[model samples]
Target: MAEQPQEVDFALAAYREEGVWQVQELAHDVLENLEHVSSALRRFPGDGGAVGMVAYDEDVFLLVRVAGPTVRLLLSDITAADEWDLARDAVEQLGLPYPEEDDDPAPAGDLDILGDLGMHAMDMGVLIDDYDLYPDEMLSDVAGRLGFGPTFDDLVGLTSA
Candidate 1:
């Protein structure tokens, strides 16, 4: 078994500054959980989609972005052999746990059926935590944050009302 990835102290510090105690703890727990669950996910052809740590000068850096069930390390100059080694090492040494994969397709991204503002709020929270987003920006301001422009407001108006 491979060893678990050490927590990112800086990211934890960011959590302390930007989030409450519960939020920080939840983020920590989710990330730790992801580490284990990454195993058993189909790799994207060789080590392409394996969830393993990337290093700079052989020192770990960056929390390598994971998309859906895919995992990719952010290291440079690594060969396919090295990548496979890292992937297997993470699964075996760190004891990564994966959610049981089911053949069923995921549901649509809708919570309107919940038919309550509270349920919408809960769904929003789930979306925010699952992916990185600009916390300080409003939905109307998201495009501006991403360098798209203030036109996002116009787009929203056209789509909704």
Candidate 2:
């Protein structure tokens, strides 16, 4: 597994530009919880709503895209259960009772968020169960699946091999 940081690392707000994807690394302090995630969405001055990715540790990562009342979710570890504020806020955002997953890594919401963009459900399923990868790696997969692999790798400070 890649090294994971203890505190929140960094976030990226991604939006499509003329059919091409673009990613921008956000300030580390810009994200702390689901509310901050929502704030970032509201602050985006793009043509469409932007998706937010927050990686807390190797075991915790959150994918959020808010469109009005609906906040789509894709969490890496369901066991975080309030252990991390990011996870806690996600459950709150979805109004779901925490600690009820029965110890599973299955994602929380629509696995096919990027299905329309490029990723298929089966591919997203594989990524969700890949516990060996770190949060950044998982988010990298998400970005890649959504048609922004190289851009995501560059923005996340990862070099293509």
Q: Model 2: per-residue lDDT, tens digit, 1-161?
A: 12222466667888775766767876655565577677777676544567888777556777787655556877766667546777776766667667765666556666776676677678878887887888788778777767788888887687766
Using TM-score as the measure, which candidate wins? Answer: 2
Worst 10 residues of 2 by lDDT: 1-10
Global fold similarity of model 2 (TM-score): 0.82
Instruction: Estimate TM-scores for all models.
Output: 0.22, 0.82
* Candidate 1 lDDT, 1-161, residue by residue in tens: 13233422222101111222111111223234336434322322222222222222232222233345644332221221133333333333334332133322111122222222122435533533432333222332222322332343343232323
Candidate 1 segments whose C-alpha is farther than 4 A from its true place: 1-7, 12-26, 33-59, 75-161
Global CA lDDT computed for model 1? 0.28
